[model samples]
Target: MNFQTSFPSLRKILVGIHDLGRKMAAGADLSHAFIMLDGSYGGKEIASSLVDEDPNSPKGMEQLKVRKPPRQISIIRHCVNTALLANSAELDLAMGPSRKASSLDGQSRFLPVFRSGSCSEIGPKTYMEDEHICIDNLTDHLGVGADFLSPGAFYGVFDGHGGKDAASFVCNNLLKFVIEDQHFPTSLEKALKSAFVMTDHAFADTRSLDRSSGTTALTALIFGRTMLIANAGDCRAVLGKRGKAIELSRDHKPNCNVEKLRIEELGGIVSDGYLNGQLSVARAIGDWHMKGPKGSTCPLSAEPELQKTTLTDEDEFLVMGCDGLWDVMSSQCAVTIVRRELMDHNDPERCSRELVREALKRNSCDNLTVIVVCFSSDPPPRIDVPKTRVRRSISLEGLHLLKGVLDSNG
Candidate 1:
């Protein structure tokens, strides 16, 4: 069925703030399933690629150093040498296979139990040009039968530049296109990549809208134990595995290595880190000014880079936010704060609120949005560091040498 016309034109009836506690419908009437995935069905978004990202997270990570040295206590026992290699957040946890739930026989015992919370604010900025959507239960949202093998939920953050129309349009329509894609539920990666381009194209074809306005899109779609993250532009997705920060999506900043190569390859010169000495992002949706012709092979692409991972017991929560929060805090810092908050209160809403507040306190220059999706209701357990042990022994020859040295001195 062509689901393109299923959703009527809903300009901005969505809730200003969204929170998902098991269900993402808090304070909003989204029973139509049109709020997050708003297009009728198989509706489109556009062209794509990585961006010159700067916020949510940097392509370059700032490693945390431990300033406090170990106290010089008298070593009564032999011990091995040890040093703190790096912070947990600085570590890049490897991504598991993008296989189906049935393929994860080992992780079969660990299914995702989602509870999400989100907050968006016009920090120091005058206008709120950011838009986002949170749906914890896609099965219910889609009105589909309960199938453990299908997609479970969806979340997205759209950061608009030039204007809010692009962000608003993408947020409302992107997911609908994904679910309505012919490859949906079976070939998720293909469906998502196709959906991103579709949404970008759809935005470009729309009439009565400013073609110049563009937005960076970051989306997280969870199916059973498999999570597929599609990102373009700079917004980021960081997964909290236990207490460690695991980056699920890369920031598509123009300064980023891969994005830079692509920009130069497409004849798009990035001057002062801006694409073609104009836009900051290398990729985006609805920037018809930069795109020119429909399939012109422009540098400002809208096609998203997809990252897939199988969720596990160690995976605790996922944080999706715009560059505002990231400009002030490191991914490690964000994860630490969220982990501590969850351990204390186990509330995703409070965590989201706290993250926004922290960013504002740090004097963020742009609009702020953050969504914290927890996999379990239980608070994260405290991470304990194991003590390092080593046994040191002296040989008989060493003892005799010491005695001979003492005798000579006497």
Candidate 2:
């Protein structure tokens, strides 16, 4: 068999292979070509063969498993199917296709899946005046009839001044009041506004509690993809949208131009950035001593300003923190730091803890409370910074001027 004579035989073999590939590409069945081996698929080492196929399990059924994922992953939560599986040690946790992917394909929109973490510290303060709350599963906590959207969450950071009574009270009862209002589950904005005013009035009525104490309230409530932020006083809510800082709530301080005008219109005085030369914030709750009556408008208002936005894939997380954190750190800095931390390890609790630690390092003078709520279990993707080429050139006049100056000095 000379090499030149064997060329036609090799061409025949290659042609035959090409025809087989085309047939496979046309969806040809090749089940007979497959071989079963222990290393081929994830399963227990059972003494079984291809001939011993169980009728209960159809072809490709073994690939669909109901697996309990690792504890680190909190994003993929719901079980849409009623399949039971065993031998967790042998199978991967991918259970099935991504519910989020399927849901997006069906709805043609983005929906938020919320998970939160929080940390509070009495840093550099003798007494802790900051109180915060985190509720990841509002329906389970408040019952199913609460009318909240599925996959929802609520977060708040309360900064108490004068005492801890107001902050603690709001942290405990604010949500309850909001949910129990007549307008709740229907008009959330109205319900939230009324709840703030009512909470203040109720505090005024409670003789045992310190009505003179006050707190700045900031809350972030999410239902499906929509997020509503309510704020009064200086505590802030900042949304981390793909490493950029999007301020959700404005800091209501005495020195703000709008607040100053409002205060002056209401006959309130601002002296040295303090309203009425005593309180630092323009609006707050539980400061009944400064207010006139239950429903009457006053300089020191309890009404909260609300802001709402729909969360999208670009929206990564939300940062709700008292002024302690913002006093020393910029919102963009915090967002950048938190995004980096999440990408390193998708743990919001650790992210919040580290954020508090950062504020402490910055010498923040007040009590600190920070809540970090991530929208997905997966970490944020890295931001690709566009590379720029900066061409540096000097003018001939500048060079001549430099030479003249050198000659003069000589």
Candidate 3:
């Protein structure tokens, strides 16, 4: 069944801000769902008509019958007075506002994403096992295009072993490289491959400073309707889809055939069914000592499996973490807790903190990293790719366009 109506201006404006704020506050520990917009769902017309049109679109509209009268009335009012005004304000801001702000200067129509949260303790052990990084600048955005610019957003975790060098290296450069790659593929798969290889080489280049630094990486990239997920090592990604846990990525281990083959090809040995008879993980970013034989064709292959999935309403949120959090919590258990948290708190990052707290409570022994990607709001439309694609360096000028839209709408 379908029901159509216009949203009021003010209501539209506020919905955007309220939704963005909710997302920003959510961080990594919450569940989210997106609402799709049909061609018939006219924001401007809805905004203008909602103030006067009957709350009931059609007398026999069965769907409308099920909705509460107050909610229906409020929806119309919201669309007109807030949503529409905010949307217009955003567009005006994007186009370059001529006048100074007045009563509405403080108001933001677009909703930003939630901030991330974390915690750690000094255990009796002489060393530290927990590691983390939270960049609010990146979390609140997706990406932006001509038709619809998306806010750029990503989350990641690196579980370090041997030492903290690996994990720390990734947290510092992974996102920067991905965004800066001149050859970053428009396709998620290709882009991810490029990123993995580039990131590996970047580490190798840094060997001059510290050859032992390497990390296990699990990253989630959210842009438009595509969610690009890439992973190497044992870090895992599990999705909470419609309240059920769905494993989205594989955990590479020593026993896996691919890992075994790669290990042997790189001149690395497996003893006691372990990588070099030490680490149980088959794939990892660093560990030069465990890499290729003196002069073999094999090197520390950091090949990552890149998956691109078109998001839908059924897609809720994703949990990406080092084994620390996963070691202590089952996918289902994590989802349940996050789902409950979202009920009480709509922020994703706050949910992330709660996850870390839960892990610490369970006494996870490894350094922990967690990245959560929530599909809570309607994503902007896909960018149109020109038939004759011209590659241009993404520069400050190009980036400004993104900032402009985000500042206006997001």
Relative to the true structure, candidate 3 reaches a TM of 0.57
Query: Model 2, stretches more than 4 Å misplaced?
Result: 1-108, 147-149, 386-410
Candidate 2 residue lDDT tens string, 1-410: 78636664445434444544575678965332122221123222111322234313664335222222344542212211123123331233454357556766754466677789999999999999989989998888888576654566788889999998998889899998998899976788999999998888788888778989999999987788878899999988888887777899888999999999999999999999999998999999987789897888878988999999977888999999999988878777777778878989999999999999988987989999999999887899876545559543643333433443343335
lDDT by residue (174-237, candidate 1, tens digit) is 9989878999878999999888889888888999888789999999999888899999989999
Off by more than 4 A, model 1: 1-106, 144-151, 387-410
- Give the least accurate 10-residue stretch of model 2, judged by summed lDDT: 75-84
lDDT of 3 by residue, 161-243 (tens): 66667667777777767766665535556666777766766676674445465567777776555667788878888876655
Q: Residue 228 error for model 1, in Å?
A: 0.5
lDDT (Cα, 0-100) at 290 in candidate 2: 90
lDDT of the candidates, in the order given: 0.75, 0.77, 0.59
* 2 versus 3: better TM-score goes to: 2
